[model samples]
Target: MGRTSRKRRSTLTTRMTIASAALLLGGGGLVAVNVYASAQEDPGQDAGGGTRQQAQQQGQQRQVATIDCPDVGTSLPDVPDGARGRVDGELATLDSQITEAYQRLASNRTAAAQDPNFVQNSILGPLKDKRGAVLDRIGQDIRRSGGRPPQGLDGMAPCTGRPSEQPQQPSQPPSQQPPGQPSQQPSQQPGDGSDGGAGDGAGGDTGNGNGPDASDFVDIKSVQPNVAVPRNQRAASRGTFTTACGRNENGKFNPDNVIVAPGVSNGAHHMHDYVGNQATDAFSSDDDLANGQTSCRNQGDKSTYYWPVLRLQNGKDEADVGADGGGKDQNVGEIQTPSSVTLKFDGNPTSKVVAMPRFLRIITGDAKAFTNGDANANASWSCTGFENRQLKDKYPICPQGSKVVRTFRFQSCWDGANADSANHRTHVAFEDPRTGACPGGFKAIPQLVQRIVYAVPPGPGFAVDSFPEQLHKAGTDHGDFINVFDDKLMQRVANCINRGDRCT
Candidate 1:
């Protein structure tokens, strides 16, 4: 199926109290609680001491900008029939253009992407920011008409929590870095047609940084499952499979390779990074990945895992706004990546998960994020658990019943042999949604689906992280993953997933 638009059911407005990104914790270690206090002990004599009293006084001294937004007046612009379709069509078209902008940025070198002025003026100004204007209009019309506005757009992020609660993540696993240092971003650029290279990380680039892992901020309880997995079902002939491929703290934003399949280099035109397995790349074999170290909770599970990189940029950065849109010296605003990204094994909301065959290539999202379906824009953006068949908004606020989730499902009907194919996709096919099992020619295996959730809300100043060149925007938010599970280990996962065991 191709990308399609749907009517809004509910949405938030654009009003916001803008604040500095620095004030937010961005997911760091909790501040240590002071246990001892003394009123007269070195009140003024100690320079190393910031007494609890002094700290509280200083906090009081700082002025906090607060905004209490009133809901828009009930009166809404009456919409003529077909107006929604026109806006939907416009949004679909802009989706393509904005994707291209991110692709162009990914194709460029890091220096060019980070050049500041050029990135803002050339890419973001003309492409990303412009696309955002259209999204803003779409959202406003939805609001005025009493329809649900799209989430993830310029003004549609949720406003339920303080932005400070959002997370800022590092590109390397938390184990490698010291307490509070971000790993050095690789200087190498993409499009090695001559620019630079994916660059060798063999010895020094273990991708270590101080920022907390993106998953740290997610309070598992905040989002609950709306889909009910069947309590019991006929077991697959093959054992079940499941793996808690924890979110990677070291995934990089490498866009030039395909992490969703083998032999299809650059199939995903956006960006993604891999972790868990030390040696995951386009050409990596299943064995190579299984032997690699894992950052997942389970030590025995050396499954290679990956997802898109999210960033947080302060609003003051001169380079935040692009093109001539903001005019001269006008600050563009704070840029934020999605608040969360997650992965889970699930079934179609109505059926039980079956075992998946080995070498199945499942593409969960609209690889193209559009119907044109050109480079795997099979994009899927949702606010809850596994209601993937019901893709609606271009971006959605994390719905109350679920977290802001993005899921990727692979084809499970494997051809029985050939771990991979030249095309990188033909080896596996989708199952029958109704039966929850693979069709005639192929047998069923565990259904693998990854759900990535984010925390950006309905207020102002949150956007996806792009190469400075792409100029932060929401459509640029995307993710992908490829599995090269060891043959025997594959059976173990199948056993785990089908046995109804929640072993994270």
Candidate 2:
């Protein structure tokens, strides 16, 4: 989205400090922990005779990393066609409200330190009230459209402060892991208490002191190789269709998400690197996309492929430092252009692929996975030579001569009727993990596998842009696609896949 000519918000003069005591529940009892007043304090002996190391450890326990709220979009029932537009606008407003509240929380750390209930009474309580009013409006819209609205939406209004400890890893069965990825292992670093081991800490400061600490990166060499090729049935559509979409060299960047928040500017709250259809703003209609310019080598594919832009935390600033979806959203750093981008579509292992409907919108991962949980997370991070090992929650610290890679393998199953769903996810589904088959009643389609590589000075210095509250966690990485292909080209894609021909 283009930057609007509105008054700019004041910048936070200092980084946030956590001084409030957090209550912990342990052994069926509530325990309060002591916290220091400032993060920049020098380690010294306390009156209680605690060592410097002990004091620093206690300080780390009290840090509040970011705000955590329930995802309202994921909890909503099917919205009526007539009310879809209103419902979507309200959802985007909800996200914007969270971003604004997070900025307040981060900037007013001193006020929070003075009063224990400052965060609850001042920030979260007011946010809850705002969200409750919006929820009521959403309910009214659905009812007016002759649709039933789900109850208990107000319960999702209240948010909490998440501690700065290591993020929780998604628990998945071995069969649930990606086709060639290995099972996750505990951190090799002793006493780190992180899912992945300690990182090299090359990123220096987590962007604006919000998230993605040293624990978010791991050396790819430490991971064990465990990639296994999937076994295909005799009737499988074994072909692949590769599309040559350039690495967004034309500088098509925007923060509008047409699929999720149509007609609303800055709906994504973060910048995205768009590669395919050039006219893909939040206001782009299907007709607009059909006539838009294409970046793909073949003119027939006017499909849109975009994802959050990756940024380096090397103490630099971009042109959007003062604009929305950039520094104003607490996403400060130099936006990194990908060195290579590969968009390939593969067929299902047990079924023949069908032509994807025109205007089919698919979102691969959850942007709010850090707090909403990793149930829908589908991130895959690895190095060039260490592609056999994939990390869902950690950025890879690539070795020399290796480049950082971010991959998103989109869902392959379509619900046959809808090009999109109320929640943007119900219309598409991933294949069954063990059987390599589509879910019952869903038809198999060409699965989009996007591999984006970056040539950076390898370390823990880069992160994908995210909503301010998401804290730039690697697990929150996601991809968005809207198929705008012509009927002739789509049929050719299906034909190539079904005929077992690898065509480009």
Number of the top candidate by TM-score? 2
**TM-score of every model?**
0.43, 0.86
Instruction: Please give the lDDT score for candidate 1.
Output: 0.36
* RMSD in order of candidates: 19.9, 7.4
For model 1, how big is the CA root-mean-square deviation?
Answer: 19.9
Q: What tens-digit string does per-residue lDDT give for candidate 1 at 1-504? A: 111222223221222335433232221211111001122243453576555554443222111101111111111123323344345344444534444443343333232312434434555556645555666776676666566653444642111101111112223222211111112121111211121111111111001111111211222233223232223335433233345554554433233333332333332333344554555554455555545566555565555555544433332322222221110111133322334444455433223343444334343322222111112223344554435222211234343455455555555565565444433444555554334455455555555555556665431223333322122222233444445555566556655655556544
* Candidate 1: residue 56 Cα off by (Å): 59
| Candidate 2 Cα deviation (angstroms), residue 384 | 0.2
lDDT, model 2: 0.75
Q: Which ten residues in a row are the worst by lDDT in model 1?
A: 62-71
* Candidate 2 error regions (>4 Å): 1-63, 166-178, 181-204
- Model 2: worst 10 consecutive residues (lDDT sum): 21-30
Query: What is the per-residue lDDT of model 2 for residues 1-504, given as tens digits with 9 covering 90 to 100?
Result: 211122213322322222211111111111111123332242555666566564444333344446788888988749998899899999999999998887777666544544557778888889999998889999999999999888787688788876644455656543334454444342343222353211113233343455566677788888767566568999899899999989988888877788888878889999899999987888788888888899999999999999999987766666666567777676767778899999998988898999999999999878888887666677688999889888776778899999999989888899899999889988888787666788788999998999999998877778899998787778889999999889999999999999999999
